[model samples]
Target: MLLHPPSGTDRVQGLAARLGCTVAEHCEPYGKFKPAVLGSLSGLALTLKEFGGRWDRVERVYVFANWPMLEAALEYCVRNRDEARVSA
Candidate 1:
C-alpha cells in the first residue's frame, strides 16, 4: 500500500530481506497493492535504519499480508503522506 516515489521498489525489497521478510512484487486484483512483503521481522534490526532513522520512514519499508493488513496499510500510508504534505 505504500506509494513509493518513482523507483523505491528494489530498495524496499532489500530492506524486507534484511529484516527476514518474503517479498512478493505483485498482487492481482488489488494491483494497487502490488509488490508486497508478507510477514514481519520486528526482532531483526530494520534495514532502513540509515534512512533518517525515523520510525515512520523506516516503517514505510513496505510489507503486507492478507486483505485487512493491506487495507489498513493503504489507509495509513495515504493519511500519513497527506499529513506530511499539509505540514510541509
Candidate 2:
C-alpha cells in the first residue's frame, strides 16, 4: 500500500502501522526538476525501483493520496495496467 497522507497529519500513521503498510515521508521540494519530482508519485516509483527484481513480481498497488498525487497514480496505473492491479 502506498499512502500519501496530507501534510502535517499523523492520523494515518497509526492506521498504517496497524495495517502493516510502509509510509513514505518525503521532505524534498517539488517542481519539474528531477530532485523535485521525487516527492510525489515519482517517489513511489523510486521506492519500487529500490526493490529491483521484486518490482517485476509486484501484482497489486494500492494508492491513497490526493489531487495531483492521485492523478499521477492513476496515470501510472493506466500505463502499466497489465502488470498489476492498481487501486486508488
Candidate 3:
C-alpha cells in the first residue's frame, strides 16, 4: 500500500498503468488520509520511484505478508514505542 496526498489520481493511474495494475484511491471526504494505492510490491516500488514525489507526498507505505506477521509487527512496534517512552 502506498499512501500519498490528495489530487494525484492522474499520476497514480499513469503509474499504475505502467505497472500493469489498477489503483484504489482513498482520498478525503470518503476515506482516511489523502490516497492509498494498493498493488504488487514491484508495481508499488515503480510507482514510488517514478511518481511518488521522492517521498514527499507519500505519508506511509505498508507491506504485509500474512495476518500473523502483520500482527507480530504491529505488536513489536507498539512495544518499541512504549519502551521508548519509558526510557525517555
Candidate 4:
C-alpha cells in the first residue's frame, strides 16, 4: 500500500520500479486490507521526509498495518507535534 498525493495531483506510480514490488491495490481504506510489508510505514515516512517533491503533496496515508503499529505511529506523531500521515 502507498499514499497518494492530494486530489488533482498525479498518482505516484513506478514506486515498484524502485522498491521491487508492484502495488497490489490503491484506494485501500484503512483496516480493510492487509499490508504485504511491515517496513513500508517507516520507509515511506523517511522517503517523504528526505525527498520532498511530490511526496510532500501527499495528504494522507491510510494504514493497513496492524493496530499496534498504527497506534504507535500516531502516538509518536502526536507526541512530537508532527502531522500524522495516517488517515482515518
Candidate 5:
C-alpha cells in the first residue's frame, strides 16, 4: 500500500497505481494487499513511544516500517501545528 502522506498522497497513489500495486491507509481484508515501505525499525519504535503520549496534537502515517517514521510524523504535526490540520 502506498500511504498518502499529507505532502504527496496523490502522487504516491498515482505512482502505486502505475506500478500495479494497491495503496491504502488501512490494511483491507484481502490476500493481495501490501503496506507502503517507508522507513527503518529502530527509528520507528522510539518515535511511536514518544509521540503516543501526545496524541491530541499529532497525526501518524500508519504505513511505517519503523517507530522513527511514526515519531517523525508526530514531530511534523508538532511543527506544522496547523489548526486546519485538526478538525472537529
Candidate 6:
C-alpha cells in the first residue's frame, strides 16, 4: 500500500497498524517530489525494487494517496495488468 497522509499526525499509520499492515517509510526517489508522500511513480518503482521480489509477480496494490499518485498507480496497473491488480 502507498499512503500520502495529511501532515502532523500519525492517525493513518495507527489505523493501518490496527488493520494488520506493516508500515515502513521510504525517502522519495525524486528530489522534487513532496517528502511526505510515498505514492509517487518513482517512489513506487524504488519501493518495488527494494522489496526484493519479482515485481512482475506482484498481484495487488492499494494506494490511498493524492491525485498524481493515484494517476501514477493507475498507469502502473494498466501496464502490468497481467501481474498486478490495483485499487486507488
TM-score of model number 6: 0.27
Q: Higher lDDT: candidate 2 or 4?
A: 2
TM-score of each: 0.31, 0.26, 0.32, 0.27, 0.25, 0.27
Could you give me the TM-score of model 1 versus the true structure?
0.31
User: Which candidate wins on lDDT?
Assistant: 1
Q: What tens-digit string does per-residue lDDT give for candidate 2 at 19-85?
A: 3333343322242111011112333565433322123113233333233443343344344643554
For candidate 4, lDDT tens digit of each residue in 3-76?
33233211122332233222222234343542222223444565333322122123233332333343343334
Consecutive 10-residue window with the lowest summed lDDT within model 3: 62-71
RMSD of each: 12.4, 11.4, 14.7, 13.6, 12.3, 11.1
Candidate 5 is scored at a TM of 0.25
Candidate 5 per-residue C-alpha lDDT over 1-88 given as tens digits, one digit per residue, 9 for 90 to 100: 2334443455444443433333344333363322342333233334444544222112232344433444344444434434545752
Rank by lDDT (best first): 1, 3, 5, 6, 2, 4
TM match of model 2 to true structure? 0.26
lDDT of candidate 3 over 1-88, digit per residue (tens): 3434345345545544444444443334334443343444442454344433122235333333222332343334345546878999
lDDT of 5 at 87: 57
Candidate 5: C-alpha lDDT: 0.38
lDDT values for all models: 0.42, 0.34, 0.40, 0.33, 0.38, 0.35
Candidate 6, superposed: residue stretches over 4 Å from native: 1-7, 32-88
Q: How many residue pairs clash in each candidate?
A: 1, 0, 0, 0, 7, 0
Q: Which tens-of-lDDT digit does each residue in 15-38 have in candidate 6?
A: 334333422333233532221222
